[model samples]
Structure formats: structure tokens, C-alpha cells
Target: MFDTTRRRTLEWLGIGGAASIAGCASQAPTAEDTGASTSTAQSTSTPKPTDTDRVAADPADVPDPISRSESTHHDITLTTEEVVAEIEAGVTFSYMTFDGQVPGPMIRVRQGDTVSLTLENPPESQMGHNVDFHAVYGTGGGAVATTAAPGEANGMEFQARYPGAYIYHCAVTNLDYHISSGMFGMIVVELPEGLPPVDKEFYLGQHEIYTDKGVGESGHHGFSFENMANEQPTYVVFNGEKYPFTPDRYGTLSVEQGERVRVFLVDGGPNYSSNFHPIGNVWSKGYRDGSLEPPIEKHLQTAKVPPGSCFVGEMETPVPERIKLVDHALSRVARRGLLAEIDVAGEERPEIFDPNPDTAGSEDEEGSAY
Candidate 1:
């Protein structure tokens, strides 16, 4: 039944050609046909990638929390580069990224800190790029001052005036195209007192991939302008790949029981809001829109992280189980490949949840609640 539903969904999207619906073929839409920039060399498909072509950013690569009370000035530099990398085992995409990684890098600072940021567009870049930080108080949120063309460098300075997690992304005229192709990241401004410490922290970014090829296609995929304009994404993935942190790809995010964990998520969605939820657990504390202000919501089953927005959610791992991080927009997980995992390892508490016990033989053998 699930396969049948998935097939119908793909067919509705005009995904694969007639014969390539359930399966995939080594073919992709042309750049000219899809309105993708030619920088990625998508005119011709390439063979599957080697180790050097994997571009998914590591989830564990996060900056430590700000521990100081005094404000300070920081210098930050980001380079914009266009690269073609693997999106899945058999699929590839042309990504316009900051520092050559999706969602760029996390920028952390304390409230009232001065930030001098530089954006460099290398000579090899095919499109101009700039950053518009949601935390900045300036023209276009510093986008106007930092718009750099190919081979040029632009700089701007701003004071982190608020305490919140903010999203920074390309603010060019074609920002939707760039962001959907992987050009956004998070900027965390810590409060004066800073946030409560957690046993573990994981940083992740979510964005839709608008590709010309259908899901499961075994070749290079090109950016689709029509799809973007229609807000129909081919894949809604985390960290630039389908189920990137799962055991099948990169290993799961492991932690011990009874530990408190915090996840910082920035949604780079040029379109589509993420119904962020953790299966088998609830957000013990959720800071919506990434605000660390008082009156934090508690015990949320799901939280909406909209496009161009952010979320900071905390979880209490009291039991040993694999918690699945997913967008409650069910189809996105069932079909479009949006998934992450948190593996909690500890002894099972049968009193809380028992898979099998002595009561197993008490019910009717041939009857179920249904």
C-alpha cells in the first residue's frame, strides 16, 4: 500500500519518464530545460561519486555555547562556491553553498557582540551571492552591503542586538534558487546569561531540493525553476541528503539514556514549513523561532519551523530507543526522504514499556482490537 501511494505521488509530480516511475534511470533533465545555472555542468550526467564527492556537512560540527558574560568583537569570513555533489547513493545535485557546505556554518556570538563579516565570491563562481542575516539590524539585514559578484569580496559589521537563533542565507534576486540549492545556515546569538547547558548538542539544517529529476533517479539532477515556482520540491531532506544521519548513511546520533540533548535546526526552506517532531519522544522544552527568551514552551509533540526561520528543541532521553527526527508532514518522510535518528543506548525499563512478558498468553489467539 505504501509503495502504491508513493508511486501515485511521484506520478503526480511528473517525476520519472513513463518506464522509470517505480525505478530510476541514468538520465536527468537538461540545464536549459530546467533554468538551472550552468555552473554545475549539469548538461551531461556523470557516473556515481567517489569519496571526494560527498558534500553533506557533519551534524556534530557545532560551536560550543558562549560561556562569557562580556561582549566582544568577532571577525568572520565566508566563501561562496558552487559544487556538484552526491545527494544520495545514486543521485547528485549542483549546490550553491557557503564554504562549500550546505547550510553554511553555525555563527555563534553573545548578545551585544560586534560581528564583522566578509563574504567572498571566488573567481570561479557562476552566480553572485550575499548574506542576509535575520539577527542583523541594517539595510536588507546587511544584504545590500555584502552583495558580492563573482571574484569580489564584500564586508559589513553589525552588532548582535538580540538573543535568539537566526537564519542567514543568500539574499540575491534569485535567492529561492540559491537557497533551495543549499545556501543557508544558522546564526546563534547567546543571551547575556547564556542558555542552560545540555549533555549533548546537534546542529542540523533543513531545506527543499527542487530538482528536475525525480526521487531515486541514478544520475545528476538539475535545479527546476518551474518546480520552485510551483513550490513542488523533489526532495525535502536534512543536511543535503536523504536520511543523512541514519545508520544506512552516516551513523546515527548516539547518546546514553538519562541525558538531556539539544538540537538546533534552521529551516532553509525557500518554501514549505517543517513540522519538526521526534517520534517516540516529545520536546521537553521548545524555543520557537529560535528565541531563548523566557516562557519557553514545554512538552511539545511537534513544532512548526517555517521557511527562513529556526527552532531550538530539547529532549529528555529517559529510555533506550531509536528516536526518529522527522517532519510530521508525513509524506515528506514516507516519500521525499526527510529523516534523522537519535540512538539512545541503555538498559530497558520493562515497567515503562515491555515488549513481551508473562501476560502474552492471556488474550484470544485469533482476535485483535481491530
Candidate 2:
């Protein structure tokens, strides 16, 4: 899948010519050129209250995905910083984050609401940063208006004119590198009537990590510019870490049987698309690319979530089982360390799923079906 996509990307780049992209990628921004303020007074001042303060105060601090509120103005703040963190047990990489988390905070608003967004590049950040919201309809999707340098900040106001889940990511020069390094998130503009409530909601972001080292290599890994340009990644992971959702590590997503679950997924791919699928379950209702219109695809086995896009899918857990979430790209799961699990706990429904039916009279107690 990546090979095909990489060929296409290369073809597109060749035909459109890489001159412009090369020019953009070549001119790395310097602190002076980025207009980072150096005033002593500004340096000593505290950060101003962001829009999130006025409304959804400190909502980004939590991991639970946020839901839409009543139609109104929303103030959202996103700060950019860089951190070195473990990608897996032994592998580590430098990540560019929003508000100190990969995939950033889930920003929710209703169609027709006004969004006052603030983008800040902290003093500790190493480069300039900006945001491009796929839901917006203006130049670079508000990127041009919101580019901020280290210690600097910028703001933009736009109406949430559409109802959908959209991808938002850093749009600075060499955006592919920035996004691949973990500088993206999702913004949900819900319909006026709102979506049907579910028993659980989980947010996940998918992005590939292009490291100079191979997977599982210990010690700090550095970004591979060559691999990124060729669309070859060493790891494709969820929530910015390898297999972080498994019970053996952080914990598995738990829910009762018969409960409805909604998974909000964002693919921050600087390159490949995601063939998002759950191993033992299907999307009972799917809002592809966050579309809120009628004719939502039902009972979908998998959905294509492209780079700079979002998907909202609901599942009905009818049986007690573990559902593995994966990118059907296969290689990502089989090789690149992409995995998540949802453990459904409740009384077993033998009528629906009988694992021991064939072994009822068998003498092989060790081989009882499960």
C-alpha cells in the first residue's frame, strides 16, 4: 500500500515539479527570521488567558475526547512544543506536540459557532509552528493567519460553517516532517441536533514515525529525512506510541457487552492513508471523513482515513470478546508496531457465540474451545 502511494506521491511531485516544495523545505526558519520577540519585558510576562480559559477551561489536559457543546463562540488554545519520548519499550524519538500531547486536544464545536483559535509556540520550542484546519475555507485553512514563532503567538477567528470531523495540524514550512513528528489533532464540528450519544467515546490518532534507526532499536532515534521523502516509515502507531492501548502496557479499552462505542480517529499521515478496521467488530454507523449528512455508511468492515482527515465510527459490542483495532494495511500491524485492543466484559451469550460447542464431549480438556 505504501509502495503504491509512494509512487503516486512521487509522480505527483514530479509532474507538479518539486521546485516549490524544495524551496519551502530548504529555507528553514531562524529565530530572528521567524520574528521571535526578544524583549526583556515580554520575556518576563506571563502567558495571556487563551480562549479555552473563557469556555472549556483546561480541557486539553485530559485524555478523554471532548464532545460538542451548545452553539456559541469557542476559544481554543493550542501550544506547540518539542519533547523526546519513548515510542515503544526501547525506542525513543523526538515528537512535536500540541499542548504537550500528541494528536493534541479534541476541539468540539457546533456548526454555526464561531471559533477563536490561538496558536502559540512556546519559548522552549525549537521552531515556528502554525495550524491548518481542514474544516476552514480560507487561505491554507487558516495557516497563514496563525503562524507563530517561538515565544510568539497568533490568533484567528472563523465560523464553524461545516459539520464534520476535520484534521488540524502544524502547517509550517516542511509540514510533512512536522506532522509526521506528531503535530496534528482533530476538530469536530457537530450538527446542530448533535450526534446520538454512545456508552463510550475514544479518540485515536494514526501517524507514521520515520526514524533513522530500525524498529526496537534502543537509545534515542533521530528523524530520517530520506525515509520521510520516500514515504518509508519504521513505525506506524496510534496515540503516538507503539501498542499503547493494549492491556499489557497502558490498559485496554473496556466496555460492557451490548454497549455502543464511538471511536474518533484522525490520520495525521504526512504520507500513507489508514485502512481502519476492528478485527472482530464492524462499524455499525460510520461518518466517513466526519461527514454529518444522511446516508451514513452502516456495517462497514473498514474505512479509509486519508492524511489530514478524520473518521467517526460507532460499534455495537454484542458479544464478550477482545476486538483488535488495526490498519488493514497489514504490514503496519504485522511489522511496524500498530495495535490497540478493546476488551468487552459481560455475561457470555452462548446462544450468540458458543466457543465450546464442538468440545463438549471431547476428552481433550486442554483444548477446550474458547
Candidate 3:
């Protein structure tokens, strides 16, 4: 049977091809889509590639799809602790996180794997939160999974049913509170088996935090999924911490002229949009919205990462140097989100080697954010 919801979302993603969707698509896709549409169908949204549309893709460039695998189970524990006892730091708020990180840890399993998660929330009481995984076997990932009661944590189990990227977050109190409080992450349920691991992978997601500044001691903010569409993160980030915090933890990305760097941006917490920038350019665009679709070739400075998405792109740093990665939104980059570095060194380039800032444009509006 055809799925009307998936059809609408796919069309909106500019999939199937819409050149220049950098602008909005005039009309919405209809339910009549039979999946008979060509993979190369014009977006009817973006500008068609010029007469020189088809670029000769070298077989060497397109690596083979990694063999996906399936395993019986994957179990893990996630905890949220206040770094400084009762005091809140950074944005001056104690957040609900997994494994002590905002976006939590990156978990991968085969298509049919049985993944179990045990959660632990800190003592400081707030709204209760629970896990709701999109890749689970039923009910949009167990939204009915009763939330953890204050200090008490809960456990849930589900089988990976699909072979695409799926999102997991605290769907505790509707789509409102939990998400805004920084409770979300992604699980790449490998297709049956598992996809090949790239040279390097990093997990980052957009987050929304609710806060009010006070002249006295910094007020502890209460983050929730409220006004996420409007109150974007004063800070955007990679993994859990901000820029400098990443290098020592996740380490810096090192690459040569043609090595491929896979950057995985998952949205576990729903709030801010993530902007990822590689020094030179993205060498490959293999997956979109968590599935292995086709190869996209883009060489730009800033890349927008949406929620529930796990986009894999490549980077070929022209020369060895320090490259900066930040949320494309200037304010968040400066405030509470994520920032990091890449070590690109010892490289030489041909005549056409250069960096262009005026490349990719952020065309997507705020409400339909990632």
C-alpha cells in the first residue's frame, strides 16, 4: 500500500530532484504519487542544472554501499547529570540529556536489531521525560512509553523495522515540552546488515533552550520544546558541548586532498538548526533523511542539518589547515550551540583550488526547520 504521509515529506525534502529549491516549491505534491516518478524527475521547484547537468561520476568516487547487518540486540544506558552539583552552567540551565550529553551518544544497529535503553534523570525535578524512537516496531516509537517520574528512570524495547534513518526523542507531553527541553537523538538502523563505517563520523543536532536572563545570579533556565520554531538556540553545537569542547573529546577531523569525511548530524533534541562547514567542500552526498538515496555533489561553506535526519557528506580538504565548523545561524554559533575544528594539513592543490563563501544559500524557512 502507498503511504500518503511519506509521499508528502519526500516531495518537500526536494528529493526526486528540484534544482534551486533554494527557493520554495510553488505547489505541494499530491497523494496521487505512485512512486512511479523517475529518480531524475525535475524538482518543478529548483532551477534545472544547466546544459552541462550530468557530471561524469567516476566509479572510483562512488564507493560501494556498505553491507548492512542485523543483530538480535543492543542495550545501552543513558544518564543526565548536572556538571556542577546543584548549580547550572553554560546557558545557566540543567538539561535533560543522554549519557551526560545534550544529543546523547550515537547508537547504530542492524535493521531487525532489538535495542533497549535504560534512562537515568538527575535529582533536580522538572517535567518528566521518556524515550520515543521513530525506528521502533510500533506507535511512532512508543510515545505512550510513560515518562520517567522525576528521579526514577524507565526502560523500553523495540525492534528496528525499517532500513532508513529514524529519530528518537522525549515525546513525553505532546510535541511541545519534552523536545524543547533537549531530548532527542538519531539511530541509524542499518539495512538488514550494516553500512560500512566512513573514515570519520560525528553526531550533532539542533537544540532549543528556554531561558530568561537575570541581573542577579544567572537564573537556571528551563528548556522545553516550546517555541522551537521561533526561539532558536542562542547556541548551535556538535555532539553535546560547544566548539572547543569537541576537539579533546571527538577529536579534530584530519584529511588529505581526496579522503572522504562522513559527518553525521542527528536530531535527538529538537530546537535549533545545525550548520556544518568543512574547510574545502563536501565530496559526497550519499544519504538523505537517513536513507541511502543517491550521490549529491556540493562544495559549499555552510550546510543546514534538519531534525530526524542523518545526512552523510564527504570532505576533501585542499590543504592541511584548521577548518571551522559552526551553526550557519550566526547568533547560535556565537552563543550556546556547537562549534568545532578540523585539521586539514599537508596538501597541495591544482590551479582551480580556492574557497568561496558565496556558495550554498540557506533558503529553507524557519518553521519547516530541520
The runs of at least 3 residues in candidate 1 whose Cα sits more than 4 Å from the true structure, single-residue gaps closed, are: 1-52, 361-370
For model 2, the stretches where C-alpha displacement exceeds 4 angstroms are 1-70, 359-370
Report lDDT per candidate.
Answer: 0.81, 0.74, 0.48
Clashing pairs in 2: none
TM-score of each: 0.86, 0.81, 0.63
| lDDT for model 2 | 0.74
The candidate 3 region of ten consecutive residues with least summed lDDT is 51-60
lDDT of 2 at 215: 78
In candidate 2, position 228 carries an lDDT of 76
Measured with C-alpha atoms, the lDDT of residue 216 in candidate 1 is: 80
Model 1, span 1-370: residue lDDT tens: 0121223322333444323321122344344423455333452465344434656778788999999989999999999888877888878777889988877899899999999998888777777677889999876687656666666777799999988999999866566777898999999999989999999999899999987778887787877776777898999999888878888999899999999999999999989999999998999999999999999999989999999899999999888988899999989988898899999999888888765578687555663311
* lDDT sort, best first: 1, 2, 3
Which scores higher on lDDT, 1 or 3?
1
Candidate 3's C-alpha lDDT?
0.48
